[model samples]
Target: MENEEETLLKSQDSVEKRLGRTTLLDSGEDFEMLEEVDDGVDDDLPPLEDAGGGRKESHQANKTVKEITDPSQCPPQEEWLDVLGNGQLRKKVVEAGSSPDSKPQRGQNVTINLKTTLTDGTTVEEESNVSFTLGDGDVIQALDLTVQLMEMGEKALIEAKAKYAYGALGSSSTPVVPPNADLILEVHLLSAVDAPDLELLPPSERISLASRKREQGNVHYQRGDYAFAVNSYGIALQITEASSKVDISPQEEEELLDVKLKCLNNMAAAQLKLDHYEAALRSCVSVLAYQPDNIKALFRQGKVLALQGEYADAIRSLKRALKLDPSNKTIHAELSKLVKKHSEQKGAEQAMYKKMLGNPPDINTVQKPQAKSSWSISWKWLFGATAVAIGGVALSVVIAARN
Candidate 1:
């Protein structure tokens, strides 16, 4: 008795034969199925909440902010002092700080409580205990520039023109600000600490600090601010490298190395997004130097090399990655595309060379002298005969006439 599988197969074969075609089968190609790659494009950077765990700055805007429409309720213009001398930014000290002589400088990491509002007293953003490195552009220009003028524990009110705030295109995120909207901010300088010399810190502390910076970078990256992301990652990298000379336990050293590699990889990702191909490639090479088999580094290195027109090296790196993870559809898809592109490039180069050299005409197509037709040859002979006869008759007539 024929089983169901056998019957189906037989029927299919018969139909294929009748149609004069063989049934399709897998060609065993390495990259047969193309799929979308998660090449860290949409990847969520490691969350800051668990990274060192001291404080995570709030990104949520104040949804229930109240609006005060009365003009009388606003601060008087007489008390506002121009901080920048350009009149774009003005400050009014609400309360004096504890340390009058010590103010936070540009490079210090500072913590603060801030409340921002529109000109009509509509609060747009409010957060407490938010910390950021000064002059890092982590906050709005108004906050960054205004906070510099305040001493430790000082409370101040700032009025920033649109140029110093969100500019013509106002805030697009939550608590959206309209275009060309001037802003008012109430700022409390909680504390200011100078960025420590990483080399002086113990290895454990250095690693923790580096991790925190890396988390900060992640935050910047998630917000689509690639340049700032690169900066934060670069700072984290500096912190990581600073601890390498310090004597530490083997475990601590290993952990530090891991963190350093992660920072490099993340930085490379950011650099790639920014189209800084050379810088991104160098970062990938740095990671590969420490850990040759690092998959993420290898993958990114391949992409960077391809962008720089180094197809051979790119293919090599991607092949290595694919070897490590043979089943990764994303890697397979990427490698296939690169291989196809390289082939097309070679083909185009060959075509261009052929065009420059100019193809020789085929011997068969070259025109040969045509043999004269019988009719034309006969006509030429007849004309020559007639000319000769006429000349002879004329000569004879002249001789007879002279005689």
Candidate 2:
């Protein structure tokens, strides 16, 4: 029995050594360790920690891995800077030529001449003079940074990301800059111009003048005084033109075109109102040439044609207008009345011709006798057969009675 116990103990110790773990032997009242291994084997292993602690503990490792994967997370290699003082530096460069100077001073007005294409495929050549106080929030962040670094009359090329320009929302009129888009710009510092003072002309007076002119034009147009309305519109156009030139900018070109289009359209309306059908037609045609799909021009053209006694042409024009504006009850009523009058006139002419010619038959008419229908023929045959049978039956009955 002692020999068997010794053999079992030795076998257990061999198993524990092979597994690299400490094992205990049962000795009736006490336990004994069978294997002894060094503590250095698993001492360097990671410590078991909770989720939060684990993240905090492994932050350095995670950062290392991220740096290896993405190099953009590293610090910028070159300092990104902007030379223009405005947020629109990128757009300015693309539209205008590069600036000649190297620095711009505080309170300096920069004038830039630019040529830009409109959304409607119209090209506008214009000049812009921008003046703002340095270090003010009036300029974009990137532009402000550049201005701080520059001296008076200095110019430089600036690259701006969209975040520094218009950001994600973009400008209302033109969306040149997109979100996160990188842009390049060249800027110049021109002679500074003094800001206009409202004290010279009272704000109230300015407002009153604008309101009075607009009201005068409206009243004249309503009262069928087209010449007066045209004159007023001309004055308004002049004012807008002057204002646009005073603040010479690339965007002003678009505004100028709009003003001109409005003036031309209003002038045409006035001419039509004054019973000058030919002149009105010419004006409308001119506008149509510029804007082929102008609804007002199309309507005015149709009205002028109708006034000129060109009923067919008027109808065609009005029909086209109606197609463009189907829900227009006024156009529908007008067309209906014209079509009815034309039909009535034709009917009256035909009646007069028939009376003059003694109701002569038309050359295309046929004069054939009307034939009876098959149903009527069948009914007649049946009636005749019934009458014959009745007479024969009466004769046979009389002969039988006599026999």
Candidate 3:
């Protein structure tokens, strides 16, 4: 209501000025006496647009476009910040984030909604709302630097030089920014996950955090994100050890150890899915290192080792696992498989050995001579005649000498 009145007064003043009526026409000579008229129109009601054939265009014109004429209007600039080390880059915080306590770390993974615009106000891309790990060079350096300074649920506007973004080459074919162009990024951090710092936290806190992380890992595992699940479990294990290593009540100790074992087992499961046998083996070993008779660890170790073709070690681990949990059908089945595989491998090796270094050839079977034919008799006669001729020549020579 107030805005309409204000607009009306402004319009009236402008019309009066155009007519050269500095003061209201004191006398009624210039204009006839006009009486106040009420048009039954609500003062707050919007003016009707042109009721013409181009109704849509008329309606569109009714909307008052708010143009940002000032850089300060972009966002509330509480303070200006020089960022990205060399101090060429900067950010103006429009609205402070809600979760000031949840700021992202250097190596944490973050999901953000990004809006890139050129100085001339051309939209470069729609790749905002994308997920990526920070500090991995998966995104522009300016973005990484910008996000590191932002808290969860925070939004910021980044002003960056080309070097921090696309540099001289100017990024991809339809580059968001041309060569040597500065960019403005309106970014919102959707979510972030930071690796836990287990070593410093209190023991009770460690156990609690460990449990939470383990559950998070389980959720990731159920979602089939094995790599992330493994990461979560790794964090859980770190907390577990940190809790147990410090001074703790016996009950707390047991709780921490239990969480550790479970996390290790879950880690191994995820690693198995990811085909990270060595990592899976390490997880199992970690569990076994604490509790030597942990059935799950032994079984997982056996499974990993079996897949690696270490039948002997796999059998040993599985047998131990089975002995600890004799009623476990899975363990028994796995051990049987390893044993069977071991026997088959041994038999195959023996067969190979026998084939490669088998018995020497038998005398009778040793490649016998070819059978003789009519040609052999002819060859023998020729040889005998030559020998007889030579013998006769020798005998005649001996007689001549004697004579």
Candidate 4:
């Protein structure tokens, strides 16, 4: 079977040929190579399912659509124009909106009716009257990026390359998208309005929005899309932190702080998955700043520190977490592994230095031969005996004289 990356390349080629184009997107970077991009994420961290607990049903689980795998049956791509001029995203207008002059801008609240289908004519998701805030990470990056360019009352068919769509890990939504699969979307923009400032929204609404983003992050994380997960978590943090700038009841304040900290903790985990150690460390520190006793934050801080080779600091952070949650076996195991690894690292350094310096002379061993030589020992005994005889003779003469 062709791998996901190969499938992506083949699919893009097919689409490009159908559109009478040589290349649809930048072919300079392979999708697999894109996955290797430096992010501070650590590969050694536990897989999403293991670290995040059991998977939750995708929020869009109810939006399942029937699959159609006939390769020859697809929408015509002749009129498709590259939206971003980068070939990664393309669109063909099916119906023009009423207000062409008024397009949705970033941070605007937009409502749309959308039907999503795979290239094989499989309608994966169809929903009417969906609403989200633009650039808030409430929707896929492709939709958010493309929709802002859409005119009010416009209906268009969007063809997104995998990078801007569900990406490498794909989507776990109903009709499950395979990894690296491109996305086909039929979207109708119903309405677009200025989004309320996060500070202007009711405390409850802000919390709800932030919580939803956090859940969205969880979905992305479970699908092994750490980059998207990190983005979603970051949005949640922004929402919660923005809400903090406005005065609110103590209860609301506490709730917002809790949500913010949760986002920070989850963001750190996603960052770790991306191998972004410094960013992950910052996220962990942010969470700890709000709640010093946060076990998750401390534990993540330890992991990040350890990954960055700050073993001593890592040990301190883990120990702090262990002090709070002494019964946590995960923390205990992580701490033990860190301690053992640190010891091995120290031992390796010592051995390296010793090898470089060579062995030093031992003072006791150097003097031992001279001190214990047979001739030296014999001479000492002879000298002592002669001295004793001389003293004895003198004493005898003295005694004889006295007698």
Candidate 5:
């Protein structure tokens, strides 16, 4: 059966999120719609209290988030660290994480399961798993920082003070977060991988990548992994299209053509295996359009046509392929079977027509015969020798009357 399995594997709830359009600023800060998340370990986490018994005030004369002038009533975060000078955020490493070496970077895709809460300890958001690229600004700046610091399989607690979070504006997805409210985030990092930006690579390098992907698809195909093969071949095709720039050398053009031809053949084979007849036919046709007499294209095209019950057209395609590759046993076997099926189909059609309306007018003489006369049923000598007439009174009366 034809299936749709992409190359990248994903855990449940761990796919990319849809944050709105993000514009990267000149300050290297990503500003986008961010998801609200918080640690769920504690149901009654205390609200963030200003060290001065209210919102922290800066001493830069503007009363920004930095300069804490008063230390009146502050919520104690014993395990948390204020790595940056600003009191706007704090981080607590819940688990150092199983994978010790690697963590998400500035421009990589990360997948994790996360939960978020408000300062009053009400759960606002949670995902069993999700994925997003770091530094994309599809989320708030605090999340990007948190993921960057997390290693694979690690869990952490992130407290984004109102300044680094919704600020005074709050969030668009939910109505719970009041203006200037802080957020708590807890996450379990599942995986972090580098997301490819294919457009950035040069044409030759893209072609090389495409070729490698195509080979990978072939491996998948050989193992009867049609779904994976389809995805792999699709990637190769995308890269091939990217490399097809208008300003290419003649040799490069030839190289790309060869690559495209092989890719089409492989893709068609996989699609056919998966019973995606229409897509497989299209791929084969595309190859034929480039190189009309390609044996593999012709051969696969015939198989697709046969599957559609177009035996006559299939026979022609198969015969053409056989002419090109006479020694190929596979082609020979398929063509022979198709020939027999075509003959049988024609015979059945004629039989059905005859059964419905009898044979054609010219063939109707088989049932015609001339009528035989009644005189032919008797001999002449039996006329006067009838036993019933010998003793008949009518004959005697006629004889007496005549006398």
Candidate 6:
């Protein structure tokens, strides 16, 4: 028992030596540093009496204080940025003035500004207000898709290549867009209009409405509303197809066919407005299929094909149209222009080939040198022989005179 007591005292002394003199002996078993409590006091004010409880409260308070002071520890904001699957990032910049309290809904008329930069360092900035009807071909597919995902008054930056934006043909330029050209658009949602109800109309009334819509599209085309005209024409085409199931009079059928052809023609014109040469070509081809000898269709197709750089096909189509309508000044002018251009191009190619082959001697340069060489060679030999004979004669005369 005395040895055990001595061992315990020695162990306590060693612990105290390591921990310092401020070590506390709890129930004569557990040892702790008194400095721990003292350190807590130094952090804030004087330490309280309830040592264990005070440490717990202090730790909790420190946690709460950190959460309040540091924003990273706070809860996230309600509205967040969403990235689209097509690698587009969207964010809401402002709420709509029309519907300030409510979030933006679909089928809104939005205003967007687009700026496109060409490789030549030229930039085109365009601002347009587009009305979007969900699943309707009112706006561009990308813009429509983007606006559907956006809330009212939301602003988004969209990145679309030419394929998605304008397909191969770019807006208002020739030679349709090059492959994979990226376009950036900044969109702002202004107001949303609710969708119109089509179910309310009777069957006959629906047919009439569709016909009216097609006529309206024609009117829009006449009035130079090409974008809206294209949209209206698309709706007309859809309505006419739907109405084809029911029996119609011969006149009505012919009217529908004519309207369909007119819509295709208008669509071609609209595509021309947008500088979509390939799309315009397709539209023109559709029109010409129904009316094979359509002069307008043939002429426009040739023009569009030419714009697309299909020069040989363009020439063929344009020449065929000119044969049918010999008096078309436009066709004649275009033919003349193409001929001159092709000739100049051929000449330039020949010149380039010649340049690659290096400069050859001119006929003047060759003839002048040959003539001088021939004359010099003949006179040089004769002059040398005559001089030698003259010297021999002089020697003979001297010898005779001396004798």
Candidate 3 per-residue C-alpha lDDT over 26-126 given as tens digits, one digit per residue, 9 for 90 to 100: 11111111222332211121222333321022221122111222544443322446653356567655566765467676667688887666555556653
In order of listing, the candidates' clash counts read 0, 8, 0, 12, 9, 1
What order do you get sorting by TM-score, best first? 4, 1, 5, 3, 6, 2
Question: Residue-wise lDDT of candidate 6 within 68-150, one digit each (tens)?
Answer: 33788643322223323234332323332233233334443344443333323233343456444543444444565555544
Pairs of residues at least 3 apart in sequence or in different chains that clash in candidate 5: 13-129, 14-129, 14-130, 37-116, 37-185, 38-115, 38-116, 38-184, 38-185
Cand. 4 Cα-lDDT: 0.74
Per-candidate TM-scores read 0.65, 0.33, 0.46, 0.70, 0.46, 0.40
User: What does the lDDT read for residue 197 in candidate 1?
Assistant: 74
Alpha-carbon runs more than 4 Å astray in model 3: 1-104, 107-200, 243-247, 359-403
Query: Which one is best on TM-score?
Result: 4
* lDDT score, candidate 2, position 349: 82
What global local distance difference test value does model 1 have? 0.73
State in Å the error of residue 251, model 1: 1.1
Candidate 6: give its CA RMSD in angstroms. Answer: 27.9
Rank all candidate structures by their lDDT, best first, as comma-separated numbers: 4, 1, 3, 5, 6, 2
Deviation of model 6 at 32, angstroms: 78
User: What is the alpha-carbon lDDT for the whole of candidate 5?
Assistant: 0.65
How does residue 88 of candidate 6 score in lDDT?
A: 35
Candidate with better TM-score, 1 vs 4: 4
**Residues 1-403, candidate 2, lDDT per residue (tens digit)?**
9999999889766543432222121111111111222311111112222222110223433453344236776423222221232333321121222232333344343343222222222222123555453432233344544443433344434555555543444333232333344433344544444433323433333334433444445444543344556666555544443432133445545555555556666667777656778877876787778787776677667667867767677777778767888987766776776667657767998999988888766545533322345557788999999999999999999999999
TM-score of 4: 0.70
Model 1 pairs whose backbones collide: none
Off by over 4 Å in 6: 1-211, 218-225, 357-403
Q: How many backbone clashes can be found in candidate 3?
A: 0
